[model samples]
Target: MAVTLQSLETKGLPPVNDWHPDFCGDIDMRICSDGHWEYMGSPIGRESMVRLFSTVLRHDDDGHFYLVTPVEKVRIRVDDAPFIAVSVEQISHQHVFTTNVGDKVILNPQHPLRLSDEGAGVPYILVRDRLEARIHRNVYYELVNRAELRMLDGQEQLCITSGDHYYSLGMILEQD
Candidate 1:
């Protein structure tokens, strides 16, 4: 299938609760003027955005977030030593809230997470210094960018970083 100016212009997921249509069970990618990639139709921008806006599967009943990273080397900078950070855990489903990660707890749909840079060199998502998102498989997982993504907002901002690029996330931003 082809993602045209029309489809690209159609913001947001099509009223369907689940995007998996009968014809295309699971479209893992999108193709547009940008180019070809895993998360095809996603916007592009920022180093942090790349880590936040990848493939958003579904905010499952498990009470955590899930997604797949199409890119690699999620960078983690620290006070003592900053270096390219690779995911310790497999890039599958994971939690976004835990002790080692501040022991902070913010439930989705209940609270709007507050993001803060604690100098942990860890990854995070936020609205404005508030940690609003996390990783969740057995727990709340941090959301990271797998591929480049578009915000799907009117502007359709790019939310990924490859040397010198940025973007916005296309996944669902939990309703509060």
Candidate 2:
């Protein structure tokens, strides 16, 4: 899962990778406050805040904005007078046991919920009512939208640019 571009380089790929995608969920949308809305390689912070009487907005971390760690905090924006959450003690994990497939309690049938064995069959998330945050002054697309898994026969690495930034994404592998 931690594979890098080097993994593909050694495999000997070619030039000008042609791409065709078949899904909408493949995009990771980022709506930057600086009038830039782009799609990137990772998840865009699902929360966006608009500046009052202005176009600029700011990014509030899911509290896990750091480059190396992963955490999920759902607050949309930092308070005008920022305050860090302090708990009396270790935060208690709220147990959610609506999974009928996993023996437990709290079953609500109005919302779609299902889980199945993963290793032995297809694994996927259930489609349900969801909210997508789109807070940007404008619209843009990022390299995540340019992904192409070209067949290994004869293809190339990817070098696409957005604004003044240039990103070179190397070849992707194909398995038959």
Candidate 3:
């Protein structure tokens, strides 16, 4: 199948969620910690190719990453996350995250933000089924600057609202 942004946008991606493809052995492709896709110890320089592969990327229930198509699945290595949220933009009350792979996900119930301890509590946002994009440090800082204090579960917390849902960024200590 020819993987192109126009083709994917028009025809949509393959049903990776429902198709249980056979494992086709491991590939020497790795998503580096900085969101660079590397193959055989060399970085994949083609942005189009990277975006195309990102469409087929999946995080399976077995806690492994794979490049999944309708006919086959090939395991790949992910040093951190498969995608990186390089930028963030606010559209009215909604926060939209743009990934390095060219995916834009709005913060909502289905695509929620989470804090992980991988990099001393770095933030992540779900991009699609089982796939997460690590928010870049600058974007995270922007989020933090836009956060507001709110009371949740009777405790003060730093939270942000998007798509009518409140996401707790972290807890806040009361100043004595």
lDDT for each of the candidates? 0.29, 0.23, 0.85
TM-score for each candidate, following the candidate numbering: 0.20, 0.18, 0.88
lDDT preference between candidates 1 and 3, better one: 3
**Which structure among the candidates has the greatest TM-score?**
3
- Writing each residue's lDDT as its tens digit, candidate 2 over 87-130 gives 11111221112111111221123211222234422111121122
Off by over 4 Å in 2: 1-57, 60-156, 162-165
What is candidate 1's lDDT per residue for 1-176, written digit by digit as tens? Answer: 12332232233422222443332233333322121122434533343443333223233343322332332212111121111112223211221233221223222222232223564322333311222333222221223434344654555432433222332323434559
How many clashes does each candidate structure show, in the order listed?
A: 52, 5, 0
Ranking by lDDT: 3, 1, 2
Model 3, residue 139: what's the lDDT?
A: 90
Local error of candidate 2 at 11, Å? Answer: 45
Better of 2 and 3 by lDDT: 3
What is the Cα-based lDDT of residue 152 in candidate 1?
Answer: 44
Native-to-model Cα distance after best TM-score fit, residue 69 in candidate 1, in Å:
43
